[model samples]
Target: MTGATTSVELRAHNRVRLLRAVHDCGAGRTRSQLTRDLGLARGTASVLVAGLAEDELLHEEPAAGRARGRPTQIPGPHPRGPVALAVDVREDAWELAECELGGRTTVLEVGPHDGTPEGALAPLGEAVAAHRRRLGHRVAGVGVALAGPVRPGGLVDIGHLGWRSVDVPLLLGLGPGTPIAVGNDTAFAALAEARRGRLRGVRVGLHLHVDFDVGGVLVVDGRPLQGAGGMGAEFGHMPLGGGDRPCACGAVGCWGMDVGANALLRHVGLAYGGGRGRAQAEHVLATSEEAVAAGARALGRGVAALVNAHDPEVVTLSGLGAELRERAGEALVAACEPGLMSIRRDRPPLIESSALGWRGALLGAMESVFDAFLTIEGLELWRRNRGDGGPDTPERQNVTNSTFAEDNSI
Candidate 1:
């Protein structure tokens, strides 16, 4: 019995590795390539692929434009396989997207909201339910990226929206059964950066998204460092600078007061609010060069402070951060210089803009759900869901209520 259990565990582990390899390779890989990547024999790779295909988790299709020798088949995600619903809640808008196993995402819907919890989530929830009904059990999970600090159990602290301790799961109205994962919008963006964006493969990286405010995460070896209650990288709230300007979070001298869209709008004497400030900030960026320079300088200083504290290998900026650096030019670099320590002055962390751009958070949300449903236990559940006569093991029975499945709901 023990030997049998060991064999099962090893098979499960190898299967997971195989699926992950296929997932990481965006366009898909031939069986021979997967065999080499996973260090498995050709026969073993064939067995794994056959099992996944039988369960409708993956499939093998003829490689496109294959030249001559032995027609190669690329293993890819099954067309009708389980998918993840990704919801991105911005300052003034909400977006929903669907991501399949291979990281291919299709935007389903996008609309503006009034910044109120119910106002935003009610319509969003209805949309989610509609998709859930249409897709049925093929909808494996849902991931929400909110523009705020997300506590465990889907509670959120959206300071700019004047919302505190909002119960996201309750507001989302998905009730029970449907797996949901909620996280800080910027943290999710950083996750996407770490996995599929500019921060990929870096030992240490910093990812900041400058929207209505500056928010970020410090990723080490592809994992974002989540502080207690998963609120570690609220860099915008830090008092790196801003000179006594009261912030929407009720904090004075927050770095956010000097950077991001809200700060730009305020500096340019344009109206700024959680529900309706983004357009004005865009206008400022397009017209008010002075405000752009000021915000960029502050952003650079804040980046310097974070680098001094964390010493990341690279810094990736998304949203307006890239534009700020481009427009501010040398002034931003100059602002960052004074804050750097002398030893680090020679070669500070390289700051670059995220290539994923606006899609970061949405992609990250997809990743979060994929992380949950792509596990060994998750595969067992999937097999069982297909009524494939999978064993009724304790792991299979209990996997549905795992921490990532139940506790991360939104």
Candidate 2:
């Protein structure tokens, strides 16, 4: 009985590790590569692959290149397998996308939305429901990225949009049983960078997404350091920029007042409200050198303050932050150098633009959903539903039911 329970647990653990490895690879791997990477015997790996294939979670194809030996097969996400749904709810727009294993994402829909939370959520819920109906059980879970701080229990706080304590899951109308993970937009974007974008191999990294305002995450060892309540990185709220203007987040003299689209628009004397005036803001950055200089100076100084504190290996920028870096150039550097600590002035962290672009939040959301769905319990349920008794045969049922001390490890 003990041996049987151990075997079941080990099998589940190995399966999870295999899936996670494939997902991390981004391009999938051949059977030989998977076996070698996982350190599993050839027969054991074959059995595991066959089980996953039978459950419709994985499929194999001929290796891309012509090989010398037997035509080895490469495993990948099953064509009709489960997909994680993701939604990036921006300040004035939203995008819905789906992702399979190996980080492949397909944008399903994109549209603008009203400022009101109810108006924005209803259409999003409807769109998700429509996709659920079409895909049935293939929809593994849902992930939502919002332009705000997300607290526990999915409470969202979008300061600029004037929204507070928004119950994202309830409003999405996906029901209690539906697995929904809601998070901060910038945090998700940072996660995307840490996983598949610019921050992939960095030991410690900082990611900033400058939109109407600034927000970001601090990543250490490829994972975002989500604070005690999961609302840690609100860097824009820090008073790094010397200003007296009130911020939407009920704070005065926030660093955000000096940077982002709002700062650019304000510098250029354009009326901005509810995430509007992005076009005008861009035009201002392009046309008004003074506005660009001011915004860039503010952005660089604030980033330098953060650098002096966090000491990250690199800093990656996305959205309007990238534009600021490009437009500011030497002026931005001058502002940053003055603000940096004297000891660190010689060699500062590398600051660069992220290549992920708008897809960062969406990809991060999908990755979050996949993380939730690929758990041990979730995989066990999937196996049971598929009725493919790969390891747990009838004779092993009683033994498998017994609890073990290490059951929680996986």
Candidate 3:
């Protein structure tokens, strides 16, 4: 490469590195700390920090008195920096929040949905509109989390909710001007676990979110391992033996068929949801009932099978899966023992529940937004748009290197 080209690329690379360091620190990091951590000399770090401050991507706060030497500044997100509009659509309801650079979330609204995919779009649009009205120029882009499998180009399949290949973008009508990123809610839960929940500091791990049906993603080196088409990690669909009952997804003997809240409820001769089934599942866990025990054991067996296959260092569960672990945790551990192929029998992978709870998916949704817009190019675009007095536009995007991809996995 030419010298001028190399210098420009190096500056861009340094700017990106600084933004990443501030973001990785979450709430705050001292400029001194950042210089050392990012392997930049003091003078270079000062220039990079100043450049980011000019773009309003970073804000600096003077640290407390140092008795021996000059004071340092704490680096953090600009108080009035860009925010990502994050939405999570579920079988039960929909939630919308605005997430900023330091993982700060301002939940705008969370309302019940009519249990139909089409019913979700209008309210979602309304919520996004409401936040836009409030946050104004601060809102940069949108990130959506939808239940069930998602394909490229905004095609979503929520079979249980009667949505098949629905074009969510067209339905919401966000327009070409505003960039929207979509992802599977299950996958986001795994990402949230990796970022802020149980799997923190785990370089190689698996996160299984057990809601209506088990789904999740693998995390390696602080990033979710998205498949080629971003549809990988459908662990629930893994066919674990026994039972002929057809799943809502049209599969028979799927692991999802034998685990999670619905499966556990069905094992005790009931249905999933609020009332008797919920009460019975909770009550049975404290007892020696065969049905609940069997259901819990099935969960452990499935987990063991996956651990053997993937060899993740830690396993984290969310939603109903977390509840189940808390309820019949010992049963799962005991059941996993026999299923392991002799080698892992003595020492199985460490398993825990999601610290982010049901909200893990929502948190992950924000992460997708952060991954997309909290980049060197994205911030520069945001700054230019701010100058133009408009929301983030597509024309300004020159993303040479970014933390987020086009998460078109609708």
Candidate 4:
């Protein structure tokens, strides 16, 4: 590549790195702080900041001089720019939101939709298109959260949605290079919570999103476990339930049928349909505390099985059934204890609600976008600008060169 091309690539990479740093840090940080943290020089940091500010990808505010350095400007979310779109498609409804780099979420639209494959895609496409028209080219990418396991290349086979071998990319009309990522909704939510929410700083953890179906993600050392073909952490399908309950996945006695939100609703004598009747759903919500306690006991058993195997430090609950964590916290913990092996029983995992609420999946999607944009080569250039007082370390140089070469090759 020419020098100009290299410079452009480096600029894009550093800009992405800055955005990711802001995101990872949660509350905004000053440009000087970011420059220091990322090992970049003051001038290069200012140029990167100016470029991002021009693109409306970042906003700067004058600091109040709280510390013992020169007056610095704090970086904030841009008022306008490329934003990520996230769609959470449940068996009962769908929610769409816009997320910026720093995990800020704006619920653009939400409504009920039939759970079938076709029924889910049509409205989702419309929502994406409408948002695109409204926001124009500022939209970066779209992340779709599905109710069931999303196979490699975005194929889905959700039994509850009645989808068999559905190609999500084609259904959504996404073209080449538009960047559409699909994952199990619960897993994605868990990833988001771990990276930026309740599970932050946890070395090992799990997140269970309790809704119509039970789904979860496993986080080890801050990274979610992606199984062969990115289909890991399907905890709901574990066979732990009692005699012969048929699961939508065509299994007998799947744990999901016993502790998922649908199971809880059924336990409470509520019907299972996405029909227009708020009264019944509301009533179930009203009495959900007790039902949640019952489900929590069952969940505790399943989690105990996992703890025995994986030994996660903590577990967080998300989705509609996350209320169970609050209502049956002690009971769930108590139940989990007995299921653990004697050696493991003493250190049972802590169970808590997801601090990200229902927006966890969307935030995870945004993280994916940021991950793609920040290249190692750019980070090296950033380090060079920081006046580290030496040539790039051999390891750093080689990694950066390999990364740039890989990107260009792609």
Stretch of 10 with least lDDT, candidate 2:
401-410
lDDT score, candidate 3, position 244: 72
Using lDDT as the measure, name the better of candidate 1 and candidate 2: 1
Measured by TM-score, the strongest candidate is: 1
Which structure among the candidates has the greatest lDDT?
1
Instruction: Kindly report the root-mean-square deviation of model 3 from the true structure over all alpha carbons.
Output: 3.9
Instruction: Encode model 3's per-residue lDDT on 1-410: one tens digit a residue.
Output: 32335766777778877887777677577988889997889999888889888887888888777566666788887877778788888777788887888777778788776776667788788778667656656766788888777788777887666788888777776654356788888788878888788788998888887765667678887677768887777778778635677666777777877776566666666667421243455555456356656766888888888888878889888887787788778998898878888887666788898888888888888877777676556766666656443333333333211223446642
Error of 4 at 179 (Å): 2.1
lDDT of 1 by residue, 319-385 (tens): 9888897788577888998999997788899989898988999988888888888788778777766
Worst 10 contiguous positions by lDDT, candidate 3: 395-404
Model 4 scores a TM of 0.83
Clashing residue pairs in candidate 3 are 371-404
Clashes of 2: 0
Q: Give all candidate RMSDs, comma-separated.
A: 3.6, 5.7, 3.9, 8.3
Off by over 4 Å in 1: 1-5, 387-404, 407-410
CA deviation > 4 Å runs, candidate 4:
1-13, 64-71, 273-282, 288-290, 375-410
* lDDT score at residue 249, model 3, on the 0-100 scale: 70
> What residue pairs clash in candidate 1, if any at all?
none
Q: Relative to the true structure, how large is the alpha-carbon lDDT of every model?
A: 0.82, 0.81, 0.74, 0.70
Candidate 3's displacement at residue 127, Å, is 1.0
For residue 397, what is the lDDT in candidate 4?
Answer: 35
